[model samples]
Target: MLNRTSLLAAPALAAALLFSAPAAQAQISTPAASPKSTVTQRVGLTDITITYSRPSLKGRQAFGTLVPFGKRWRTGANQTTSIKFSDDVTVEGKKIPAGEYGIYTIPNKTEWLVVFNKSTKQGADVDGFKDDQDVARVSVKPYKLGNKVETFTIGFSDITPATANVDMMWELTGAKFKVTSEVEPKVMAQIDEKVIKNASPSANDLAAAAVYYYDNDKDLKQALAWMQKANATDPKFWNVHTEAKIRLKMKDYKGTVASAEQSKKLALDAKNADYVKMNEDLIVEAKKTGKL
Candidate 1:
């Protein structure tokens, strides 16, 4: 029933409004109350990552009253916290395959129940967690920290070559669980292929194999032989220091003194104070033990 002019003008007006709107305002650009954060640490040959939202205490008590004891929590603010492992890992002695999982927990005064859910998208809905989907459920004792922690934090501590402790700290309380990777077999295979089997292995490969053997308490004679080969052509002060230490462990204090003297001379030429000090200490120890 519209006139010709009215109908024609209506289309033009709709087009103008579509072009004039301010592009939907771009989500208002504000900071989140609990900001999302991700932390990653390389544990041995494996990489572990955690993504979560950090919520501050803001003078409110975190445990028992606010979060509630014995109740399953999302382990962080906002969306459920999640973790990913690059390789298969053992968490508190329970094996977890390499994948992503949701982190949930139940906090008590003395200990905590840690849950690694197979579902990465699990929410904090009423009775949302299914026990059948849980990959691991471990109990870890909580300890009171010396100082208060205002913001929740997730990090790694007590790190070694093949293991680390994933620590969760909040509100003067902390809990941790161990994550261990199978590193020995992988490293051994690498050494065999790259150094042992290769007839013409590089000096760097030989050095790497020697260090791995020395660190893992393998055959000292083989380690010493490889190290000596690595340093024979182009002697590095650090490598010579390692040779001295290996000889010392084998109870050859005279050989230790000779290698330490050579290493000290080379360290002096390189102006490396740390190696110089190390060589000096080795020489003193060798002379004391060898009565030379």
Candidate 2:
């Protein structure tokens, strides 16, 4: 019963609608309420990373009204707040194995419970959170801040070679937990495996072992022996300077002056003015202290 023109128009109209539907869907955009952030740091031989979302205060009542007390929070706005540790760590005296974990907090007026959950796949609401999957639960005291924080922030404070504090700040309250990584065991392992056991260790390898020992207040006698081996292999100005420093640590001021002078000669030939000046300063100090 349809005419020729009407028949063709029906198929054309269907085609147009099909193409326009995708275009309409593509025009939609989703804006996140909070932005994502990441923080990474190294504590001794361990690497730590934290990924989270930042939500603004927006002048709302924070503690009791918005974020209810005694209830577990996702510790961020959007996805689950995640923390990754490269090695096993002790959290508030509790040992936790190395892995990625979801961070959650139960806020209180005096103290808060920071939980590291083994299950990392969860939403901001934490609908699927399991208490049995908790790797660690640390109790940390909350401190009232003098200045108001506009947005939620997680950062590392009081950083050292072997330790750092992970701080969470929002509104006028802050909570922190200490993270420590052991350096001595790792350093000794590297020294044993790479320097001592290696059949053909390079000059750089010996020098690295010596520097580690010197920096860590270890046996200066062993460090000096390593430095001597490094010097015999390559005789670099830096290694010679390191030998002078080891001698000074050992209170052998005469040896320090001699090694420093040799370092100065090599540095001068290599056009390194910094090492020349450093060795000259060391020589002067040795003479003043040793009466040489």
Candidate 3:
């Protein structure tokens, strides 16, 4: 009853039926190794950002062993470690313009050479690296840590209004470089344009200008004048409190005691216990200085 065509088609049809259902769909898997990380910090007037991958020690030897000595490392795992600056900055006394760069470091026993390459899009290898493409380079001393750091890390430490120290650490070794941003000129220009020349600046604007001048050790006379303007506009307790401090700095103890008394009264009415205490202490200091 089986014809030649039917006999051949029978096996083909059976095979098709036996494998008709699609194979199970593939599933996504998690990463098994280094993970990406990002850090952003505002130091002075500049915004600094770093993007890289963190690789763990995993009980393996690092530094001279895995990372190699006297050779450039990507400064992190995976793609090149990238650093971005929103404004021009000086790194380790070398000027670097505002932009993004790929960080590469050559390590040694006593020192490490930090590099900021103009190129950003690159793999961890140095196949296409050119020394002429470097934006800046500086040598930093490496220090040993007492405690072991299991994962590689980069962070900003010892931060000030105009400077920050960028620290890179892995295993028991660490290196640091300082980044400084110019802030005085920027703030001074703003002060001159916004508060000094403005005909009808608000109380808050005047107060802000006064605070900046006072904090930056600028012309205290101008600071006192601005604070006086703010106080004349509102006569608020906080405004008077700042005036008292400025007067103290100017050695006007009598003025300090007078303004501090007003601040203490207003602070009590506002139920601000902290400001009241501060004014009281300032008054005591003013009396001791024979200015009251």
lDDT of the candidates, in the order given: 0.91, 0.89, 0.91
**Candidate 1 runs further than 4 Å off:** 1-19
TM-score for candidate 1, please give it: 0.92
lDDT of 2 by residue, 2-112 (tens): 999999999999999999998888856686678899999998889999999898889786777677899888887877899999998766677878889999898999889
Could you tell me the lDDT of residue 73 within candidate 3?
91
Ranking by lDDT: 1, 3, 2
Tens digits of lDDT, candidate 1, 141-212: 999988999999999999999999999999989999999988998899998998889998888888888888
| Ten-residue stretch with the least lDDT total in model 3 | 19-28
Compute the lDDT for candidate 1. 0.91
**By summed lDDT, which 10 consecutive residues of candidate 1 come out lowest?**
20-29
Which scores greater on TM-score, model 1 or model 3?
1
Give me the overall lDDT of model 2. Answer: 0.89
